[model samples]
Target: MKIGYARVSTGLQNLNLQEDSLKKFGCDKIFTDHISGAKSHRPGLESAIEFVRSGDTIVVWRLDRLGRNMEDLIRIVNQLNERGIAFYSLQENISMDKASSTGQLMFHLFAAFAEFERNLILERSAAGREAARARGRFGGRPEKLSNDDLRLIKTLADSGTPIKSIAERWEVSRTTIYRYLGKLN
Candidate 1:
C-alpha cells in the first residue's frame, strides 16, 4: 500500500495540488495537514506514519512538503526505513527502497549538503555577531532601567527602604532589584 502525505503552511493555502499528485501517484490513502512545517506536532502526519505497515510506502508531492528542514527530512526517512517502509518524493523522483541504489546515494548526498549548509549559516551568524560587538553593539533587549534609576535604587537601598516597596515603585520585581544591586557591587 502507498500512503500519501500532503501539507500546506497555513489554513488559507490549498492542498488540492498535493492531493491530486498523490492520488495520481497511486496512493491508497492520503493524510493532510494545514499547518506550518516548522511546527513539531502535526496530527495528520503522525496518523499517516501510524497507519503504515511493513510493506507500505510513503509518498509526498515534494520533499519540502514532508519536512521543515534537512535534519527533519533525514529523521523521517530513517524512521520509515527502520519500519521496513519505502519513501518516495514524486517531484524529486527519488525512491528509497532496496532496489534503488541511485535513490539511496542521492538521499545521502542531499543530507550531507544540508548539514554543510547549516554549518555555514552558523559560522556566518557568529561572524556577524562578532562584527557587531566590535562596533560596541550587543544583542538582546536594551536595559529597562537607566543610570539615574540605578543611582536612585542604590540610594534607596542604602537608606534601608523595603525591597518590595522599591520594586513596587519601580514597577519591577524584587529579583530585578537584587540583580541591579549585585551588578553595582
Candidate 2:
C-alpha cells in the first residue's frame, strides 16, 4: 500500500497542491493536516504513521513537510524503517529503499540543514522577544472577550447551552469560553 501525507502550518495555507502531488504519485491513501510541522500533536500524521504496516510505503510531497527538525525527522524515519515501511518524497525524488549511498548522504545533509533552520528561527524569535521586553512591549493582544462577555458565556453555559453553539454565537472559540468558565467556577 502506498500512503501519502500532506501538511500545512496553518489553515491559511492551501492543501490542494500537496494533495494533487500526492495523487499524481499514485498514493492509495492520503492524510492531510493543517498543523505546523513543529507540533507533536498532529493527528493526521500520527494516523498515517500508525496505519502503515510492513511492506507499505509512505509518500510525502516534500521532506520538510514531515518535520522541521532533524531529530524529529530521523525519529519518524527510524520508526518507519523499523516497521519495514519505505518513505518516498515526491519533490526530492527520494525513495529510501532506492537511494544510493550518495542519496543517503544527501538525505542526512538535508536533515541537518532542516535542524539548523529551526534553530535559527528559534534564535531569531528569542532575540525579537528580548528586544520587545527591553521596550516593555512583549505581551499578547488583549482578550476579545470582556467581563461582559465572560458573564454572558457563564449565563449561556449555566442555561445548558452547548459550549460549541455558545462559542459560535459569541464569535469566540470554545477554548475561550472554557477558560473564562474555569476562572468563574
Candidate 3:
C-alpha cells in the first residue's frame, strides 16, 4: 500500500495539487496538514506515520512537502527504512527501500552534502562575526544604560540608597537596579 503525505504552509494555501499528485500515484490514503514545514507537531503527518506498516510505501509530492529540512528528511526516511517501509518523492523521482543499494547511496550522499553545507555556513558566519568585531561593531542589543548611569548606580548602591528610589530616578524597574548591583545573581 502507498500512503501519501501532503502539507501546506498555511490555511490560505490549498492542498489540491499535492492531493492530486498523490491520488495519481495510487495512494491508498492521503494525510494532509495546513501548517508550516518548520512546525514539529503536525497531527496529519503523525497520523500517516502511525497508519503505515511493513511493505507500505510513503509517498510525497516533493521532498520539501515531507520535511522541514534535510536533517528531518533523512531522519524520517531512516525511520521508515527501519520499519521495513519505503519512501518515494514524486517530483524528485527518488525512491528509498531496504533492498535498494542505489537508493541508500543517494540518501547518504544527500546527508553528506547537507552536513558540508552546514559546516561552510558556520565557517562563513564565524569569519563575518570576526570581521565585524575588528570594525568595532558588536552584535546583540545596545546597552540600555551609559557608563555615567552605571557609575551613578554603583554610587547609589554603595550609599545604601533604596533600590526603588534609584530605579524611579532612572525610570527603570527595581529589578534592573538589582541586576546591575549583582544582587539578582
Candidate 4:
C-alpha cells in the first residue's frame, strides 16, 4: 500500500497542492494536518504513522513536512525503517528501500539543513525579543484593566473580600481575576 502524508503550519493554509500530488501518485490513503510542526500533537501525522505496516510505502511531498527538526525526522524514519516500511519522498526522488549511498548521504545532509533552519529561526526570534526589550516594549499583554481597577481589585482581595464578588463588580471572569493575581504572586 502507498500512503501519503501532508502538512501545513496554519489553519488558513491550503492543502490542495499536497492532495493533488498524492492523487497523482495514486496513494491508497492520505493523512494531512494544518498544525505547526513545532507542536508534537499532530493528529494526522500520528494516525498516518499508526496506519503504516511492513511492506507499505510512505509518500511525502518533502522530508521537512515529516517533522519540525532533524531529531524528530530521524526518529520517525528509524521507526518506519525498523518496520521494513519503505519511504518515498516525491520532491527529493529518494526512496528508503532503493536509495543509493549518495542518496542516503544527501538525506542526512537535509536533516542537518533542517536543524540549521530551526536554529536560525530561534536566533531570529531571540534577536527580535531583545530588540523589543531594548525599545522598552517588552512586557505582558496590552493593559486589559486600568490602574484604578487593579488597585481596587488588590484592595478588595486584601480586605478578605470574596474574589467572586470582586470579579462580579469588576465585570471580569473568575479565571481572569486569578490570572491577574498570579502576576502579583
Per-model TM-score on C-alpha atoms: 0.80, 0.56, 0.76, 0.56
- Tens digits of per-residue lDDT for model 4, 45-105: 8999899999888899987888677778877876787787778888878677524576467
Residue 179 in model 3: shift from native, Å? Answer: 6.2
Higher-ranked by TM-score: 1 or 2: 1
Off by over 4 Å in 4: 98-185
Q: Estimate the TM-score for candidate 4.
A: 0.56
Report the C-alpha displacement of residue 20, candidate 1, in angstroms: 4.4
Worst 10-residue lDDT window, candidate 1: 98-107
In model 4, the Cα lDDT at residue 64 comes to 83
For candidate 3, what's the RMSD? 3.6
Best candidate according to lDDT:
1
The positional error of residue 50 in candidate 1, measured at the CA in angstroms, is: 1.8
Candidate 1 residue lDDT tens string, 1-185 = 99999999987899999999999999999999999999999999999999999989999999998888888888888888888888999998988874478767866887797899789989999999999999999999998799999999999999999999999999999999999999999
For each candidate, the alpha-carbon lDDT, in order, equals 0.91, 0.85, 0.90, 0.83
Candidate 4's displacement at residue 178, Å, is 34
Displacement of the residue 50 alpha carbon in candidate 4, Å: 0.7
RMSD of 2: 11.4
lDDT, candidate 1, equals 0.91
State the lDDT of candidate 3 residue by residue for 1-185, as single tens digits.
99999999988999999999999999999999999999988999999999999999999999999888887888888888889889999999999886889878877887897798789889999999999999999999897778789888999888999889999999999888888778423
Worst window of 10 by summed lDDT in candidate 4: 98-107
In model 3, residue pairs whose N, Cα or C atoms come closer than 3 Å (at least 3 residues apart or on different chains), thus clashing, are none
